[model samples]
Target chain A: MTLETTLAAIGPADEQAMAAARELQGRLTKPAGSLGVLEELSVRLAGLAGTCPPPMPEPAAIAVFAGDHGVHAQGVTPWPQEVTAQMVANFIAGGATINAFARQVDASIMVVDVGVKIPLHGGENLLEANIRRGTHDLAVTAAMSEDEALTAIQVGLSVAGALVEGGAKCLLTGDMGIANTTPAAALVAAFTGASPADVTGRGTGVDDETYERKIDVITKALALHEPDPAQPITTLAAVGGLEHAALAGFILGAASYRVPVIIDGVIAASAALVAAALAPNSVAAMVAGHRSAEPGASVALANLGLTPLLDLGLRLGEGTGAALALPLVASSVRVLREVATFDSAGVSEK
Target chain B: MTLETTLAAIGPADEQAMAAARELQGRLTKPAGSLGVLEELSVRLAGLAGTCPPPMPEPAAIAVFAGDHGVHAQGVTPWPQEVTAQMVANFIAGGATINAFARQVDASIMVVDVGVKIPLHGGENLLEANIRRGTHDLAVTAAMSEDEALTAIQVGLSVAGALVEGGAKCLLTGDMGIANTTPAAALVAAFTGASPADVTGRGTGVDDETYERKIDVITKALALHEPDPAQPITTLAAVGGLEHAALAGFILGAASYRVPVIIDGVIAASAALVAAALAPNSVAAMVAGHRSAEPGASVALANLGLTPLLDLGLRLGEGTGAALALPLVASSVRVLREVATFDSAGVSEK
Candidate 1:
């Protein structure tokens, strides 16, 4: 489906289903609201599915969208741009941190090369959906043209549709792009109208000099583009990476399909800002997996009004945090579906 | 083992192993310290196990120690005391929230009747290890004689030993006691030097009048007992519930066996305070599962210097929160064990 169609299909969560879920939650053996955020999560998911006790978010799939940032030349990060392709290879070879997490949680992995600078060959679980060799340096010019940004988003959108059609009940976002956090900070600043200094963070453990340089790079990008939050696609085109555009599409696709999508760290959070701007109701389908250690993640998540499930100080963007949260997400729904009511269990209420 | 023997067997975790684990974490494929709290968790586990990459904390066993509080008569909670016995039956019958969560995480449940006011019959997964009918109301007098408290603790010790002997690698704490949070608050106040007004919270959703009365009850208990924090046994016997005493012994037992124990809500946190006091090194074996919405839990955990794994506003005290955290605890160790080193993965570092 086209991006416009996907955007149009997305709507607000079903309030009736949420009401039914809240009622059901009250009757469950546990005290009303004792399950805490899990209770709210289950209700939100029910609303997303338009039914109480939404389908078990099992058979989870993670799409690791990879790209390269022309901002690498700005000395914004310490890692070489080639590391993006290398890590994608690590993910496909089942040797990356995300792979280990997916294996632990029993989720499938899909690696999409949306804009890696290096030419990546076919391998298991690899999807060649590269939009370009790499984005233009955001500090000098728009990261990508409007057409390229839209095409990359379509890549994310189609990937989500394909994963759901293949029977994935839940979708997770993963990202792998060297120096991508630079663009992520730029995107966050553009969408949230926050200062670049406040939103920029040292990605992949940059030294003090590189971290300051990273902040400088983001400030320059924002000043050069003057992106508007009202125009999400144009803002994304100005400051976002190929993978960021795709992730926005992926989120929209998940919302259009009425499935819960777990957002990763800063990259996914920036993408989510775009998706929420495009379709405000898409926020209903978004689940913040964890609070990234990256400072910008908190800013972006606060703007989106999302509470993360885990806060293990994780800054890895390869969906590792999201994968770790899958079991918690699944348990929230399973409690709604499986736990007996006080009446059914013959347990006295307060 | 006797309580003295168990205490003697427990010591500080292996610092050498912790150092080795820290060194190993630096070589992992992910950026240094990117895993955040997870890296620290893995290192702690290694120290507990006396080796790098500690044994996977799989085959987890949750011990739901059920008791009744004479405080029920003091109107600290709205739930009937008999509900404690009913919930034990539900736990044994696999119909409770803890049972559902245990099933979700593939952990086994063991419901122990430590000191229910009502006599409970045998059922699947039920252990009749009762020390008495229940504790006296702390607001009126000491909750239990020193002897009764020690015997109750032995019940937890033996249960933990049995579970570990039966091939369980990780232990989780659960509690089912009507009005138990009353004693929990009292214990926290005693151990942490916090005031009743600061530590007390509405258990199972009490009304405004009942909440004020509950705080008054706790304040009266602390004033009467004058419990000393240094003498954990005396403090626990004065204001703790039978389940809280058992949970303390259970935590000590896990520490003695070198297995991690995931502490649940306020009840378990208060008990953990006792355990940590008795054996200061026992903190090494403790993992705070989640910060309960109950106000006292934070006070108790803060005194123990433990940062909880999840903070979902949970108040249910049947090991539900710990069970939800089991996967995350396991994944921390799994990442340490499975994720390849940068050298092994042929990935360039920054």
Candidate 2:
């Protein structure tokens, strides 16, 4: 399908689904009409699924899409690509908060090595790091070719699909990659028409000089590529990393498959913007978990009209924030499925 | 035991637990050290229980303590004491945010009227409400009688005991009551030695005149009852509600039972102060869920050295904030239980 038609034909927010969602507010064990918007969240999801209350499942999958940015050489983040690999090891080791939370909540995790400079030793992590090493220096050229971007997306689709087939009830998007915020800044600035300065944050707590250099590099790259927003694939091709491309596809695929996807922070947010650009209704399957302390995150999420639940000065970009927020999403669905109606509970309405 | 000894006897922080908590941060599925405090949360929990990774069960219970103040008659609150009963219906009906969130997260909710001036229906919920009608006007007499205050604490202990017996793995504390902030305000002032004028806030969005009067009433009440901090029960007897006293007991019981308790906003914080006074270790059982817009919540939590997660500018009290924060706590436990170790995942870790 043509990219525009592909974008246009995605699902809309079904009125029937919304109606079903509203009905669930009154049906759980507690009094009806008491849960407020959390009930609405559940109902909304139910309506989308054409179910009463949605089923929340164990064996959930989180994809920590990792990539490397050319900007790392520019000295924005003090950590090197080796640290990314080391972190991947840490995630696999079960020492991370996401690991702890994932276990506590009984979910599985897959670390997607999307574009690390090092050859990752893959036992279980889906090595979708297609560009072998990392993105091309955005200051010098486009981040990745259109073909590579498309391949990254295919990688995301495969991971999400396999998880769903393996009984994943939900999809959550996470990302890893040192200096990846450079690419995210490019995407946000391009898609949302924000200034590079506005979208660029002191990623990994960079100093004022490095922050200025990072912003300049991104601004320069966006000018060179001049990525087109109307054509999501082209824009992703222009400036997106393999991780961002994969995340966009992951979001779209989850929606197409009819499972909910929870979006993480800026990198995820920028990728989600691409998915939205591709298919408007794909936003329906997405929930904004927590707003990151990252500037671009809030800008992207707000532009898309999604409300984030928590905003605790958190700027970390693993699906950790998203993972942190998942229980709330689960809770939203539970309210739809569990709360009792007024007549059943013998309680009066407000 | 003397109240002083009982408070002192509450267990102190176990360094072994803190170290174990920190170690677990190294094992989760995300990058090493990414989940930060959330990882530590589980680890500390594990250390407290003396388990490598703790047990997570299906059933959980949340207790909401509600109390009214005679200070309400001083024109502090915009709402009346009667609203406490109405909102109790709201909680039961699932119309409240806490109800929506609790059902979402799958926690059983028990509401205690504690000291609401009005009576509830002659039914099961009424049995749990624990309303001694209401507190005495602190401006005139001590808000609660010494005997009544102790009885309220017994009520909290009994409820917590029942939940544990029923196999709850977690305990969450929240509260309701129109004008109860006056009692909360008085408690903050008496304990922190902050000026009553600084601690007294507009309860439930009062206008400027009402706020000024609130400060006046709290100041007068403290003057009337130069409550001793050393005698916590006596202090609570002078200015606390049945719910406040009960909440303190609930926290201690949860700690004693080794169940984690999520403390909600200002009223919960006030009760937590009493809890800390009773036993320093009880704070270990507590997780400060969210800092509410209530001016006193931070002051109280700061006094206890707990950092809040969500900061949604919420003033509505119902244990809703705590309920919302449950997913993170559950994840903390999950990280402990589920994340694969480095050896098993075959990933290298330093």
lDDT of 2 by residue, B1-350 (tens): 23344455467556776677577656543445445566567766775565667667346788877777776777776564566776677676666557767766788888876777777664344445454778888889988788888788777877777788889988888887777787887787777788877676654567799888888888888899998787888898898777788888888777776677888888888888888877778877788888777778888888888888776555667787788877777766776676665555654433
Quality of model 1 by C-alpha lDDT = 0.92
Per-residue error for B125 in candidate 2, Å, reads: 9.0
TM-score of every prediction relative to native: 0.98, 0.80
Native contacts recovered, in order, as a fraction for each? 0.84, 0.29
Residues B111-200, candidate 1: write the lDDT tens digits: 999899888878989999988898898889889999999999999999999999999999999999999999999999999999998899
Chain A TM-scores, per candidate, are 0.99, 0.92
In terms of lDDT, the poorest run of 10 residues in model 1 chain A is A216-225
Task: Kindly list the per-residue Cα lDDT of model 2 for residues A1-350, writing each as its tens digit.
Answer: 22334345467767776787776554443334434445566765775575666776344679888887776776766666676776676676655556665655556888888787777666565554455478877777777788888878877877787788888988889888888887888899889999998998876677788888888888888888888898878888778788999898788877776788888889999999998887878888888878776789888998888888666555667787777777777776755555555555544332
After superposition, which runs of candidate 1 have C-alpha atoms over 4 Å from their true positions?
Answer: none
Calculate DockQ per candidate and list them: 0.82, 0.27
Error of 1 at B153 (Å): 0.9
lDDT of 1 by residue, A273-323 (tens): 999999999999999999998888999999999999999889889998899
